[model samples]
Target: MSTSLAEHVDALYSAVERAGPDAFQAALEGIVEATQRSEPAEVSAALERLEPMLARIPLGMGPDLAQVAGAMTDFGGDPASVLATLVERAAGAMEQAARFAELHRAAGLALPDPGDFDAVGETRDRFTAAVQVRGLAGEEEAEDLLQAWYCGDSWVQPVLFMNQRRDVRRALPQRARLLNGVRATREYLGTAGWLEGLLLVLDDEPLIVLDRGFAGTGRGFRVTIGGIGDNFQLHTMLAAALIGHHLPGRAPAPAEVAAATDGPDLTPEGGIRGSWNLVDHGGKWIWNEGRPSDIPHLDGVRVVVLEPEPYQRSWNAGRAYPHMAPLLRIDEPLSPQEAAAWLSRCTTSS
Candidate 1:
C-alpha cells in the first residue's frame, strides 16, 4: 500500500521541526504529489488526516500552508474541498485569521492592492512579538489586537464561535448552568414568541430595530450570517449566548456577540433549522460587503409564509456577522440568581 497521508504529515512536521521553511516546502510538495497520485478514497482520507494537523503546525506557517492546501485541492476533484477542510478544522483565533484570509482569496473576491501595507497584519505581528517578550500580562493586549484585526476582518464570526465553544467547553466551570440555560431558552422559545424571547436574549436587552422608511409585500429577504450544518452547532451557539447573558465575569468573549446572537439556528418553530434571519420584511434587502443585520419586523403577517426572491451569489457561504453594531448596543447583564430563577420558571411553566 502507498504511504498513508498521516505518515506524510508526520514527515512534514518532522521537516518543520528538524529543518526549516525550505524543508517544509519540499515536504508539502511531496504531500501534494501524493495527493495527485492517490485514488478518491486516499484523497478523502488525506483530508481527514490533514485537518487536525492544522493545530499541531506552527501558527506562523498558516498562510503558506493554506497556499499549499489550495495547491493540494488542485489535485483533487473539487477546489473547495481543501479550502473547506482548512476552514472547518481551524481551531484558534490566530489559526482562523490565517486560514480565513485564504478562504476569502479563494472566493475570488477583490483582493487588496499588493502595494498597500497591511497595517493590520503588521500590528498583529507586533502584538505577537510583544506577547512573547512580555509574557502573561501581554495576553490582554494580544486579545485586544486579535479582536480588532482578526475577529471581524480575516476570521468569520462562526469561526470565533467554534473557537469559543471549544475553549469554554474545555474549561467549562458550571456545566449544569450552561445546559440549563440552553434548555430554558429553547423551551421558552418553543413555537413562537421569538420577539419576546429575543427580548430575554442578551440578558433582557432589546434589539434595536432601524426603520428604513419602506414597506411592501413579497418574498421576505433572508440574510445568512453563518453556516449551521447540524444541531450541535445550533446548541453550542445557543449555549454560548446564554453563557454571555446569564453568567457574570463570564460574559461572551470579545467579538463573540455576533456568534452569540446570529450563530445559532433561528428556528421560530424549534427544530433542526438553518441560519437565515429575515432582514427585510417587504422592502429591498441591502447586501453590504460588511456584516449583515436583518432582524425581521414581525408586525405584518398577511400570508404567514412569504416567498423568497431569486437570489444570485448563493455561492457566498461561511460568511459571518462580526462586530455588528445594533446587537452590541443592547447590554444590561442579568443577575445569576435571576438567570437561575428564570430558567427554573421557564422549565416549570406550562
Candidate 2:
C-alpha cells in the first residue's frame, strides 16, 4: 500500500481543509515536496523489489506504478509529478458527486486511463474498406446498393467514475456479466458486486467502470432509434458499422432516429436471415453465418453462445430469444456416467 499512491492521498486528506481548485494543486505540490525529502535509498530499494514481483503476478495491463516509477526514476523523471497528474485526472472523473472527497480519499487515487487510441480515424478507415458489409438478401437485392459502406465491428465498454450513483443498473439483478478482456473486472467482481463495491475499492487501478448496459456516449445515454434497440449514440453508429448500413456515419437526432431505416425486421417467425438484415437491425443480434440458419434444440442437450467479439449478443440472454427460447432451456441433467458415455462415444469412434 505504501508503494501505491497512499502518500499523495494523505496530502489530499491534509489539504481538503484548504479548499477549491487550488487544493488539488497544493496537494500535488505537497507530494513533490515530501517525496523529494525522503531518503533516496528507501525509494530506490522499494522500486527494485516491486519490479520483479509485478512481473510474476501480471495484472495483464499496460504498466503498474512500480513500472512507471522505474522508467521515470531510471530515466531522470519525477515520480511525484507523475502521481499528481494521475490524481488530477482521477479527480476530474469524481468532481460531480457529493461523495467525492470520501471516494477520492479512498479508491479514486489509483485509477488509470483505459489507454487512449485515435478512435475516429480508426473507425473511418476500418469501416470504409470492409468487404463484409455487402448485400445478401437473394439476387433481387441490389448489388450496387451497399457497394461502398463500412462493415466494421465495435466493442464499447463505457467506464464511469465510481462517484456516480448507478441506481438503474443496481436495481435490476438480471443483466448478464459478459466476460471478455475488456469486461474482466466486472466479471471478476460480478456486476452487482461491482456496484456495491465501487466506493470500497477506489485505490484499485484502471479506473474505468463497466455495466451490463452498452457502448454509448455521455454516461451511456443517447437518442433512441426504435429499431436500433436501447442506448443510442455509440451503439447506433457501431451497429451501423458492424452490419454496414444506414446512418452509418453518425447517429441521427431523436426525431430523425425513428424515421431512419435500420436492419431487417423479423418475419412472423423470429431471427434474421441475411447479411443486409444483420446490419440494419440492432440489439444483441447474432450474425447469421451465411445462409438462413437456426440451430435446433435437442432433448437433453442445450446450446449456448458465449462472448462474441463485437458483442451483439446480450449477456442477459438466459431469458432467451423470442420464439426459440421457449423450447430451449439451460441445465445439467446428465449424470456423471451419462456424461462420460456421451463424451466417449462422441470422441472415440465417429
Candidate 3:
C-alpha cells in the first residue's frame, strides 16, 4: 500500500489512543447520522473532534485522511462518513506540507546566527559603516542615500544586493507590498485612523529584509522602522514613506507633481500635438538615457499618495502672510492654503 494509507491508519490509531474507544465510536456514529441526513452541523462537530486527534500525527498522514474525508463526504454519511471527511482534510494538509518542504529543499536552506538580526547593536554598526562609505550622515541622510541609490545610475546594484542576501530578500517585498496596500486603503478612506498592532513588511528581492512598525490612534502617529535593503538610498525613501506619513495625506513632490500634470501634454515625438504617442505614456526617460521602451506607463494608472500632516500644519501656521507679496516661504509644514497654492502651481504648469 501507499505511504499515505499507512499514515492515515497511523493517525486514526493515534486519535483512538487519545480519545479512547468510546469517544471514537461516538464520533463515528455522529458522522454516520450526519452523512445519511446531509446534516452539516453533525458532520462539523464530528470533524472538530477528529481534527484535534489527527493533529497529533505526523504530516505524512494527511493524504490518507484527505482521501477518506473526500470519500465519506461523497458517500453521504454512514459508518464511512468519518473516514471520508478525515481523508479530505488530510489531503489538504499534506499538499501544503509538501509544497513547503519542496521550497526549502530547493534552496538548501539553513538557519543563520542570531547576531545577524541584532537591530540595536551590531546591526546599527553595519548600517553606520555603509552610510559612511557613501559619505552620508544624520537621520535624513539615510533617506537621501536611498533616493540617490534608487534614482541614480547605480540602481541595479541595489537590486542585485537584495537578490543575493537570502535572509533579507525573502521578507522585504512582502512587507513593502503590504505597507503600500495599507497606505492606499487609508488614503481612500480619508481618515487619520491608526493601524494598531504590529505590522511587518517582507520582501523577496535580493535582500530579505523585514520592516516592523505601528500606526497610532487619534491624532498622533507613532512608527518604528527597521529593514535591510539592496540599496541604502532606495530603502531610506521606502522607510520614510512607510513611517513618516500616511498615504493620501500628502501632496506629490514637485517632480512628481510636474510629471502628473505635464505628462498628458508631452507626446512621443516630443512636442505637444493632437495625436499623442500612446507609447510615451508607458515609457520612462532615465536621466540621460532618453526614452526606454521597457518602462511601464503611468498615464491614468491609479496610485496612492501620502503627505505629512505635520508639514501641512506648519504651512497653515503661516496663514497670516500678506497675499500681495510672494507668500513668505517657511521650511516647516505647509498649511491647507499653502498646499492648495502649490497644487495650483503644479496644475497650471501641467
lDDT of 3 by residue, 15-52 (tens): 56686555544544444434545455544444445555
Predicted candidate 1 versus true structure: per-residue lDDT over 237-328, tens digit per residue: 42244333432123323223233355342322223322121133333342322122232333321101111223322222221222211122
What C-alpha lDDT values do all the predictions have?
0.36, 0.26, 0.28
Error of 2 at 37 (Å): 21
RMSD of each: 18.1, 25.1, 23.9
Report the Cα lDDT for candidate 3: 0.28
Clashing pairs counted in every model? 2, 8, 51
lDDT of 2 by residue, 1-350 (tens): 24333365455444444554466455545444444545665445433433333333212221223234433343333333333332222222222111222222243232211222334344333322332243212221211111111100011111112112233123322123221211333322222222222222111111111111122111211111111111221222333332223122222233222211221222213221111122211122334321112212223221111122342322211111111101111122334454334333221111
TM-scores for every candidate against the unseen true structure: 0.33, 0.17, 0.19
The worst-scoring run of ten residues by lDDT in candidate 1 lies at 211-220
